[model samples]
Target: MVHLVKSATVPEYASITGVSLGLKDKVVLGPFEVQFIDVDMYWSRLSFHVNGPDGPKLYVVGQGESFVYPAADNQYLNITLTWIRSDTKTALIEIQSPLQKLLSGQKLNVGDTINLPEGFPQISIKLTSTSDTQATFLVTLPYGETQTLVITEGSGGSVRYKLGDVYSYSNYVYIHLLNTTSDGPATVDIYVPKVASTDFKIVREGEEETAPTTTVETVLVYNDLLYVNEKLPITVDNVTYYVKLVSTIPDVAKVEVFKDDKSLGSIILRVNDDEPKNVPNAPIKLSVQSVEPEYKRAIIRVYGPAGAHVIPILRPANLLVKIDASPKEMLLGDELVVVINVENLGRGDAYDVSVAAPIPNDFELISMTKTWSLKTFPAFTNMPALIYVLKPTKVGEFEIGKAVVTFYDDTSIETNEEKTIYSPVLTGIKVYGIPKIEVNGMAYNGTWGNYVTATLATQSASSSPLKLPMGTRTMNSSRMPRSSSACPAASMAQLRLMLEP
Candidate 1:
């Protein structure tokens, strides 16, 4: 109808509809469509649409951008976003194990995963972070097992993860036989940390597995701590022998072998702490063959936990007695002072130390008692002297006999030790007697017939009776008044006759 109807101009406007979705949320499924309709001009346009049982649209959200997606009815959508900033903050991830190279101080960014190398048995690792910032990571193991680990910041940030339970870092004991005989009874000495008890097995070459032998007796030895020294007796078999420990490093034990009881030609065997992985039920084997000289023996050692020590048995004290006599060359009836000294020259203390000094044969005891007692005698020190005074009664050459010292050790066993010391000989004294003499003399004149007066005197100042009588002996001298020349010959003859005895 060409009727004069005026045409109206229509305005065009752009329309946009959006749906928000999170990366962590489930994807939207089912068919959906988006259409554009213009009612003013009766024109419709479908700008974007998605059909079928799939999501309507899928898109990724970049950094600092918002994303939207449609959610199901009556279900609250929970979205978790792990935003990794482009900042220059770095972290260190360290993987610690025995077989792999140490990943120490390895720089890493956020959301980066550290792959550890394959290890024997199974890999177990200790992870450490050396950064002050919190780090979040996802670990995927060899078997596609995944774990989310959050390592906190600072120097104390560390984590230990076990990939499988088939691996172990425990310590084990290996018994090595250097010179041994199969099917023979043997005694083994093992030095270990103090523990309850240990079970082990003895094996030789080419034999079937057998039950283990447990050590029941343990002796404590002194070291840095109380250690257990176990002595085990076992019979060698035809299989490989192994020593297993219930604990690990620092608790390792030692074995020793001696050629004889005197510890000569000895050798020591030990399992080093760095002897690879010490898996349970598997131990290092050290086999030895027969040795030369016919006196060699094997001594096996196994230790327990660390910090155990062994105390040695106490040793008996050694006592030494010494005696000294003053005035060694003394006369009879002289006082002699004899001193007895007791000394302990051993490592241990002596108890009930007693010293006895007996009286000599030719001497008489003047001082109180001859026995001395000491309750305790310290090692390497001397006790007080025991003095004995004696007087020689009748001595030619008398020997002061040994001074005996008897004492017991400070241990509970109470071992006894004794020592004897002999003194020097004492010289005898001499006796002197009074002198005795007899004198016979007579005073005479010229003639024997003539009357004469004579006087006799003794040589000593004190008067003593002579053998000839005390009274004066008179001899007659008839020619005493004769002439001097004639009296000389006669006087000489008379003097000779009167002096004759």
Candidate 2:
């Protein structure tokens, strides 16, 4: 026997027909509820409120347009507005879901056919004949079995096959007869089972085989918060695989897949419940649940093949702040330059980092940027130097305050709390005073010789100057005259006058 090879496509389990709704009227199809709202006649547009497992949303579609939305169990729904009756204020829509639901209140006449949605395990049912009290159905299933069932009113029938002397029930399809007429019409309810992610198997030569030996069982399931550039390691089949969030933009998340240390490739996912797609030739499936662009983060789920396990790793960013002041010792009223540098020493990246340099009271801020901020700092990276100038206003030793640094990492992004660290305090900064002095002098030429005249004064830092008694004297090259005066502080200023011949 020859084997048929077909690629797996998203399956549609059930389809609903004859759904009519008025303004604010709704119909439930599996996990989806579609309500009719007002319509725009000018634009030929109709509004609908769709509520499903994902969430409630408003959709506007024109007549004959179809929209797809996520449903329960990672399934999708295709909804189309078939017709709009403006006069009756009602609209007819068709909804299809990948999961099974109750198909009730359906009227079928003899020779009527009910075809299953386009997907795996294709099936169909037909009403062959109907009596006054019984109805007959011809059911076809994916296992290549065609069975006939005759059931009375308010009764149900199931398809089954014999295996090793025991009848095995095939729950692929179920039909319930609500009422029947001899003339050839019947009202019935149909049911189909939902196919779970791991429920189906690949059949070859009439033998049920598993999807890859490694995929026979769920090896790993990872669901958590991930920051941009953060790596999540999952081990499957003893081989470690990595999923790194490359970016979080709007509703899309860019992710890079890696095996061990080698990068496989990148893929972008829009947050939704669509089926998880495996990487090419890799036993890894990734599903992005949500994206938070404000925090540059995303919530992702990863499914690994057999023997899959996750090794929890915490990535905390270590930030170190260093403050340097040149010439720790300076004179009073002198300018000082202070530089602040920040470095990331941990395994994670830091975001929205702020560094504040507090100026002491004794020092005046001449001109400087007292605070600095960094947008993104990668691991083992150093930020540019933050410099500021300050002037000492007093003559004393003081301790410089520590620089305050606050930032957030991949873990703290969820709490919105920043981790704060401070730089080491700078001590032994000394400021000394310099003595001030004032001097004045004048010179004039006389008839006999060159005459030099000057006045000297002795002054204290906080007190007035004390002058000694003035004594007029003239001196020649043979002799020199000297005079001295002292201040209250015992500091003295002396003057000597001499004439050159």
Candidate 3:
């Protein structure tokens, strides 16, 4: 009955499901929640410190978390830990695709890479390839693994991805890749968020470009074929160029030549280019033998490609060799219009038949419209007569006097050869000035005393009389005077008598 007299003492221990070894501030995980457990707070004699490879262990005590590493000592027993299964399974895949040219008509080869974003510890790319007409590939990216797709063109060349898999936000995904086959020149179009449209262009080696020209002032002059006593002063750009002359004009040129305030000499200027540089300035001379009589036109000849000149025939006066007429002349600085009607009614095809104006001898040929051809017209049509514009200095009406037509064969036919200048049917303008007369408040024609002499009613249009009792004649739209009407309209009657001085 004395058993209670001797009592046994119980030892203090932690009854944890798994043994726990931790530092002072570290919490040890266990199978059950800890309520009150005895822990050896200070047992320095049995403990020794162990330093980690990293500085000062992971013993951090921040705002909400703390970490304390246990000290390694010979007396400390190892505590095994048990892990709990919170997540059963998870999958992640990584995929990458390169750029492609849809129209290249060649094989596509590329290496791709993709970097993972922050929140996704890993992701499955689930890549696919397609073409405008067909699909090229399909693959599910495995977890945490990179899937390499050949991206080769399939039955129908195209590379595409699963629509549902790609999440489109404000920004779209665009892939760009390198191209090795295109001579280092390539461009890829990408659909992305807020980027400027860009186009790339390439420049090849040899290209091209251009350059401009020059002109010189030149002058030509002449007098009749007659000899001159003095050299005419001719200037090229205001600079007197001593040249030999050729002229066929007669009795008009007052030639005087002076060099350095001294008389060089004077002579008839005929022709100049290609003449010898000797003989103290031979005052330009021209020879008729050098000219082809057939051109009826002047001949321009060149010895070099350096651009030459064609000297025109000159007539000093409008009237040259008039049979019974006086010499016709015009003053310097005056202008005149001389019309030469050229009618080419030839039956044969003359390829280059043209009109050549023979300005009276010694006259200066100023300007002209270009020469045209009769060949350009329809068969059997007449050419418009040539009109020569002129100004003269010598007052005389003589005739060198024949309008010539030049043929492409270097031959010419003068007006005399064709007998076309003498017009049998002649016409002149007649004006009338009738005294002011009115018919009862209706003005009959107040502008009278206006020389009133009418054109004789033609015996027939083909023939007209020079004199007739005057009356105003009105022509209808056809140009023949209108048929006699009951009412006489002198207003429409346009007949005026021209006074001869």
Candidate 4:
């Protein structure tokens, strides 16, 4: 005998049975021989009651067969099942839509159509996965009436959905990450290419929330601008991503990266209108297209993840020189000593310093070399005295010419600088010689002779004394004659007395 326990629509449970009984007459028979019959039973079919577009519908599925039901977008359906017999069984169930399909442990690909209900457009699906064998699915616009997608099997998956017109000026990109792993949470990294470090800010999409703070790593720097790579931590899965908004060839500048006074690498970037662009990593060869003009302004920016350092290009050395001659006044044939002082007044060191002293026509150079050479001239310091021994040949006063100091810096050999300084002139040089004098006079003696003769002369050829009369008293007076040609009155009186005595 078979029995039905419950119906498909009714909530109450009831039962019905079919049986065969045999009896000859109505006799009150006592305990006679009795027998019991055994029967085998099984469920024939499985009935599924599903809510459809118009109303509820019924579907019957046998063993090893599947039943697919249609569903609206984002709508839930109530399902009920009824078995024909009391035996247990299994059936395959599927829910499909015009734009998508949901099945048990199955994969779908391009050119596969999702049978949705009427009045709906089929949407194409594309998928890709990365990291830890996980897959990220993407649903993009259809390409040439065909949809392509990739599905990966892994511990986790992600989905990125984008919506906008193909030619719209303003468009948007949406990213969605899904974590299928049984672990607590999966970590994901998002990368956006070709963006600057300071150009864009990150924020949550479609919500009044601040996105996680990102770490910006400077990959390279050109002309004071930054080329950067950003790292973001995606804490949750199946979350959409959106931008908040706001995000070389010429060897014009050379950059050297240093840490703790150690050089790491170097690069050269192109300069456009005094700005550098398109710089790469270290160990790169910079093109020396042209030399930078002297005194032109240039800058090198060196940076990493932590901080940056700047070096300004400027003129390295400034030289100031002065020359001096001792003993301003001297004889015509006297020797003059000249000293030159070369000082460096700039911030950088001066090298290969050479000074050339002026050799005037009136002076003769006694020094072996007129030019002096020094290895280096330190900043704000004077070099050793550059001495020149010269003899003056002319007697007239003359202004000494300037001395030139030429030097280069440590940066390059081609660069050179010069400075000139003038010395005080030589003056008041005189010529001197000895003079000769002669005198002759007549003197009178007292008793022997009325007048005596005296003669005085400076002998040019030999030394001689003056002669006078012997009989006259010796003429003595405190005052001397002014010249040999003139005789004083006092000397005559003394001569008369001498003559009388």
Candidate 5:
């Protein structure tokens, strides 16, 4: 049986409890400070001044009215005037930071690690190094990449990924320290992405369609505002659904939902529907939350089937292969060292891994394995370097093809399917022919000074030497003036000579 768990209607962002303040009184809430600037007796309204990372702003709202603070800022913030005193001398307000949070009751030692969401390992925070009052955290994010964050007590740091939106930090992971000690644990709080998971069954061809699997997990495919005529592509269980707002009439919206670009069906929804409606012939449910007819936009929540929307709760091995060629510029007959590094940054091991290194046409393998395989490579393991040497057979600019790696995902042992990934192509490899030149010079003593004869020769600087037709060469020597103390008769004579090569 499937259970429906409704998401919390409260704002996902953190909020401060209600605070009452009189005129000119200030209260610090998280990273921002709110000051009761003034009161308007005639209008039954109150004025507030807010100062935060986005800078200061003034807001005026009547009792029970709320206004989004930092209107000029990209983040979403809501400040509400919950209540006002009868005499208009003071007001009660609440502040919400839609993109940030302050976590509490988290304590960690120097070598402790914190996994966001408590158990799910999408992002990990490791306290690698620390001092009396400061600590450095190595944050390993998804896709096998890492970032360093250094923070002290009463401060915080965050890692933000690109979601191709104006407010890119909306879903960032944050870490804030509450207290710290040199030899003991540090108190902290962690703020990660707001993710909700649902469960469903994994139906097979021959088995009953109600096979339950507690291992399966689901993700929020789409939860945002969709504008009129805007086609939003949402992928669930490897199949994409194209949802478009056909049009809207007053409080009702006509939506066209398609499965794989093929028309599934059309549906009509009224603004602020209390319950969600299912799309025709699809394992998806959507509800029209609100509509702004003047703006031609609507806020819709899309949910995929519980079990079918699996996100691989079991970690899969992520292999990162890279090639590095040293001495970008080299000469023919010189050896180039090529190093292929393979790292498994995922949480699962890889099996039957094979690597195919590249060798350019103009280059010949000196010594090393161009292709190799491994039975198993564990996760978070940095394999030893696979080194190779090559000698250029021809002189010119060349590039090596990308390396190919094939491996089996340890998480999918039941399927035993093989996955292939390619490394980036190595570029800017230059080679030049050797330069061979010889010079000869002859000198003879003269009456006043010495006369010197020099010769110039030319030859092809290629693997195969080329000869040219014989030609005549000339050498000229100009006479030097007599020494200041020497007599005029002892001056040297000008000399001109001709030679053949």
Candidate 6:
């Protein structure tokens, strides 16, 4: 609505708008003239300043209003070859009423005079922020078919801006911070440390006070500056000094920092002054040396701010054992010999280490030995761990899950002590049973047509060169070469031999 300020006596002019003013008198919806859309494909969403009618303005019809042919005279004039889709879809080409047509940051109306900012192009309409910065208002206008007002800031740098009949949301914004303030004549350090994204905007402090600062929808970078009177402290001769400064980014931002040419690292963050930290572990050391001005920008600082490093370790246990047995995998009523092995997995030697085994109901122990070294079994390797052996006479799964080997050592220390190394062990086992192999899949007249024995077994963990099984020659196969007599499993090298022509 536009009110003539010329005199209070002058009646307030209803915005010659369809929604705000009365159009019932001079206009109706009878369709004497169709809405026109001209040169839309050539100039999409472009606005044209049509000189409105001389007398009262024509208003567009809206919801709930009755229709009729516009009363007498062509008050709704512009009947030309144009593109307008009336009463069907949203209007793209707008026909704003007269009043808003003249607003230039103050007030206006159709035919009312408006002074364009000096140096600003008269052909282009634009708006400026509180700080006289460019806008990125990518919003759709609302109310009065459409509206365009030229926003201005006395005289300074500016960018293009289209007006709106009604204000609403637009596209995202971007902001940049440049250091410039009476506070800065010295080096002002700003640390961003972290951020979400970087498309933040700089809003003139005049308005937009409620806009977001740091959001996932935006990005921010800090711009700090050192001018005068600001306490920007620097250390020298083991003493602290201060300076004043001011920093700015066209937009608000948080500054992340890097120095010299590498990432010095983030500022040390502390939750509280009392939290016991282990970063400064007893066995490690960290020191910071006094630095010179030539290296003022150094990330590795030397001074009162020097910090320590701490290593955090938790109590650990690693164990393993391997067992040996006689007549492995025993059968019912078969006598069996078993061996058990255990080891200490501590940093210090243990005491009172022992061995354990489950006694099967049908087995009887004829003899047992808890101590066995190279002297007990001179032909085999002696690992010198806690070992035990027993003979059994029954069947079923025998477990030693409850066996406990106890020991004591200095688990804690307040003074220097010798570092001790104990081998952690994998407790494994070997059992014994007899006649456990099954004989099946018998065929008559097979191969040599003779009775023979086959001994099948898996090899040791040691990597000894594979040797083919030795066998007596059969009457029908006595002339085969050694390679073909009996071969080891077809490994990588053997596969190549078999594939050879």
Residue-level lDDT of model 5, residues 1-501, one tens digit each, is 111212222224544445667777765533456777777656487787777777898887888888775673555557788888766466777655564343557787776777666444356677766667776777754323356777777777666542211112322566776667776777767775332111112222244434223332222344446678777776666887878887776778789998877998888988656446778777776666567676576766566654334222244889999999988998778899999999998756788898888998888999996448877786668877888999988877889778899988746675877789899999999887665544534333444234433334445544433344444444443443234444234223322232221
Candidate 2: segments with Cα more than 4 A from true spot:
1-282, 285-313, 438-501
Model 3 regions more than 4 Å off: 1-333, 372-377, 408-501
Q: Which stretches of candidate 6 lie over 4 Å from their true place?
A: 1-326, 370-402, 412-501
Please give the lDDT score for candidate 3: 0.27
Q: Give me the displacement of residue 239 in model 4, in angstroms.
A: 33
- For model 3, residues 1-501, the per-residue Cα lDDT tens digits are 001111111111111122122322121121111111112323211121223332232222211221223333221112222321113111111111122222232223221113223331122222233333222222111111122222221212112221112211111222222222221222222222211111111111232211101111111123112222213333333334332233334322223345435655543323322231122453323222133223222222111111222233222111111111112333334555555554434322233455555566544566665664443332234566455455554433334345555443112222222211221211121222222222221113334333332332312121222233555443333433234353355553333433211
What is the C-alpha lDDT profile of model 2 across 182-300, one tens digit per residue? 97579987766443121221122234443422123232256557888888888777788889999988889999989989999998887654456576656878777679887787877
Worst 10 residues of 3 by lDDT: 1-10
List the candidate numbers ranked by TM-score, top first: 2, 5, 4, 1, 6, 3
Residue 103 displacement (Å), model 6: 99
Residue-level lDDT of model 1, residues 1-501, one tens digit each, is 011112121111111112222212121211222111111222111111222233454433332332222333311111222232223121111111111112434444332233433321122221222223333333322221223334333211112222123221111111111111222221111111111012223222244544433222221111111112322211122222222111222324333222112221222233322212221321222211111112122222222222223223364577777777777765445688887777777756777777767676667888855447866675668887788788876535566777766666746334344533343433343311122354443333344455655555434322222123345566545524544453334233212112111
- Which ranges in model 4 have alpha carbons more than 4 Å from their true place? 1-312, 368-371, 410-501
Task: Tell me the lDDT of model 3 at 254.
Answer: 25
TM-score of each: 0.26, 0.34, 0.17, 0.27, 0.30, 0.18
> What TM-score does prediction 6 earn?
0.18
Local distance difference test values of all predictions, in order:
0.34, 0.66, 0.27, 0.35, 0.64, 0.25
Angstrom error of the Cα, residue 110, model 6: value is 99
In order of listing, the candidates' clash counts read 38, 0, 77, 13, 1, 48
lDDT of 6 by residue, 214-286 (tens): 2221111111222222233333334433222222222211112222233222223121112111112121111
**Candidate 6: minimum summed lDDT over ten consecutive residues — where?**
492-501
